[model samples]
Target: MALITKTDLYFTDYSWSAIEPDDPRVTGEPDSTLLNRKEGYEILYFINKLSDIWSLKNKSSATKIERMIRFEVPSNIHSQLTIRIWIHDNWNESRY
Candidate 1:
């Protein structure tokens, strides 16, 4: 059997005040808010490449897979936030 390694991305330090309305640092616009802070904030992370090397050795067998990702946010922030995830096979280097 081959070893499967896993990694995770953790997000923290999110506070209501940091993203509240009328936060000048968020944007120069008078009505700036966390909802429209900037374009760069839209992306969370990117994986350069993902390959199923094990598939080559087990071509005739089907691999059973379950939920491989878990997203957890503090209960306190759950009601006040919106989260989105996007998966793309290719990404721009500059975006990283």
Candidate 2:
């Protein structure tokens, strides 16, 4: 079985994040090969939406969506992660 050392999560609202590089499940680099696929290591994740509301409805002008992500891992170790959120059309790269 191939190991899954990296994980990419995406949301319907166009938000995304990745967990990689120093992920606790990754014991070491995989052997150099055509696919560079790792073995033996695996990571499992349980995704749940903390908030009850998935979409905004009759929200006040003062209210806003926070662009942030927080999660806990079994290893209790810190790893570098990146998250991308779609703020608007102008901010999109394809426009360039």
Candidate 3:
């Protein structure tokens, strides 16, 4: 497969896929992000995974980063969780 770009991920606040092994909702917009249910916990799992990915891929150029994720498992998801990313392109792909 070809290398993936950061934007491809930003499109998702969270992801739920067997390929990456992360739950959904983690990447959903906070205000729009749903929690307090199975979907919420699923999102949490996804947030953790994204954090891991962003750290490894965007560490140097990442001017800002936040999972905006809060709350413990089996608890109510935070109403005001937030995540941010510096959004620097990691790959050497040339853009005209």
Q: Which candidate is the best by lDDT?
A: 3
Instruction: Give the per-residue lDDT digits (tens) of candidate 3, residues 1-96.
Output: 112234432324444434333323444334434443223334444444444554545433221222222222223433323222212231233121
Candidate 1, residue 45: CA error in Å? 17
Clash pairs (backbone) in predicted model 3: 13-27, 14-26, 14-27, 25-43, 26-43, 66-83, 68-82
User: What tens digits encode model 1's per-residue C-alpha lDDT throughout 12-81?
Assistant: 3223233334334332321212232122121111111111322323311111111111223222221112
Candidate 1 overall lDDT versus native: 0.21
Position 71, candidate 1: lDDT: 28
What are the candidates' C-alpha RMSDs? 16.5, 15.3, 12.3
lDDT of each: 0.21, 0.22, 0.34
The segments of candidate 2 whose C-alpha lies over 4 angstroms from its true place after superposition are 1-11, 21-44, 48-96
Candidate 3 stretches with Cα past 4 Å from truth are: 1-28, 48-96
The collision pairs in model 1 are none
> Residue-wise lDDT of candidate 2 within 1-96, one digit each (tens)?
211112322222332235464654333422121111112122212111111113223222001212122221212322212111221221223222
Choose 1 or 2, whichever is better by TM-score. 1
Q: Model 1, residue 1: displacement in angstroms?
A: 49
TM-score head-to-head 1 vs 3, winner: 3
TM-score for each model: 0.16, 0.14, 0.23
Write down the worst ten-residue block by lDDT for model 2: 44-53
